[model samples]
Target: MPTTTALPPSVLISEVGPRDGLQSVSRTMPTAAKLAWIDALHGAGLREIEVCSFVPAKLLPQMADAAEVVRHALGKPGLTVMALVPNLRGAEAALAAGVHKLTLPVSASAAHSLANVRKTREQMIEEIRNIAALRDERAPGVKIEAGISTAFGCTIQGAVAEDDVIWMAEQAIAAGADESGLSDTTGMANPAQVQRLFKRLRAALGEHAGAAHMHNTRGLGLANCLAAYEAGVRTFDASQGGLGGCPYAPGASGNVVTEDLVFMFESMGVDTGVDLGRLAAGRAALANGLPGEPLYGMTPEAGLTKGFVYANGRRPATERLLAPLAP
Candidate 1:
């Protein structure tokens, strides 16, 4: 049997609550509340956040204040503000907002491509190329991420061929994207499949391979994340309270819960640069922003395990719990 090495000492947890989470909900969070949530998340030690998407407000009223939100997020020191752009027009607006990173979702499944963006796979790739050119001309220093959504299996078209996903990653990279990654938009991925696909993605893109965006729709979110970790994926995308889902993906659930994912890595002695206690506290903001929306997680409900030590060297949760009250 082959010996397995320990996971990396640190991992990047890119929070996507503001973009992916809010977009799926019908009620739009007020701009002030959105800013508060972003602030609370940043205070929890999250260095990277997908603040908002550059889409038409008429389509997604939840993201109407995208530019304003981006501007506020930029004021936070040390936070890498990222935004999702659908095409060249969105990319132009995102660049004007001075976002640090811009992610473009290019669906691997043809049916998903048509349903989500009303474009075929080839046309989307051409759009990505144009967006890349615009980025080079306007903001050469900004990073572009081509996130291949529905890379696992699509609800619209079942059993997306792995070859098609790999080809899309190659095409995105070849078209001038700075990085490319996979997204299980429909939450149909298993652990074994996660490991296999991510390994192939890394081999194909090498240094350009990016974050693993997994959903918890089928309840395999964390398991798939571990598999990806074992396969050499360091950056993981997650949302607070597991908010948000793909509008086109029937029965699709939200992204992986940020608190649970952070707890998983921290318990394994892997530093995520986030404070679990503080991260959980940010949930109050989520609740206030999207009142009545269902939030899900295990660690926040059960509290940290007994004698739990944080990755950032904070005192164990148990110790903090058992400590005598300070006068």
Candidate 2:
């Protein structure tokens, strides 16, 4: 029998493609194809996936089948089905859908908050409080995560104050969020800022410190994720093929690529519990679902290094050493 190699998972990679990727695009993916793409992602060992958003169909028709998608995902054993919700009503809908988790989008930038969700940061926190209360009443098992968008910098309000971001995160937590994570909605985050902000977040929130949601708009997505990892962040939000962004937030495009981020960590001996080859199959499903749409990822295009070895004791037949290069 072949040796059973099981390296303990070092990090949690929450995939946001099924929701964010589809919502940002102009066309709606057929329900069958959406389910297939999700199956592919699950097949690739993606444990957590934000399958859809529970908003009004008029607002985001692409996510109209949120409940059906959640139902399909629920059939997958060991998979956490998550959905995005903006307000208490959305949370109720998601709870009804039987999702495993709910991620609420709360923009740290007041301007972006109003533009995206039509509410102020203070009001959003109150909404979170209500949503959490409802969750406690309806489905206590589901986790509620607050994703603070534009936490790094806002396209509408450039250069958001770091203090403001921290304050917003604290407010969300106090308002009853299980965890609060920051998002580079405009893709303006750098490695230094990422490290500093996440460090402060960990200190303030302690165990409540959440995932880093970085974008590849300016090509620093992977670097920022690495910085967050160094700052003790274990959960990361990434999209398949870099297919995600905010339609409300101008110039905010390209979520951190799932393939590249997984490769970055696994290559550095930090197990992401993701198989690159399997991930490519998921990518193919994504591409097939939305034909003619371009997908992006250096790891997918450049291919994994020869004799690559995963931190989890899995590797090619000719295993090569993975290490840092001498400067």
Which one wins on TM-score?
Answer: 1
Q: For candidate 1, what's the RMSD?
A: 5.0
lDDT of 1 by residue, 235-281 (tens): 99999888886533444456899989998999998889898777755
Residue pairs clashing in model 1 are none
CA lDDT scores, all candidates in order: 0.89, 0.87
For candidate 2, the per-residue lDDT at 42 reads: 91
As for model 2, its CA RMSD to the true structure in angstroms is 5.8
- Candidate 2 has its poorest 10 consecutive residues by lDDT at 318-327
Instruction: Give me the runs in candidate 1 sitting further than 4 Å from their true place.
Output: 1-8, 247-253, 316-327
Error of 1 at 264 (Å): 0.4
- The TM-scores of all predictions, comma-separated, are 0.92, 0.92
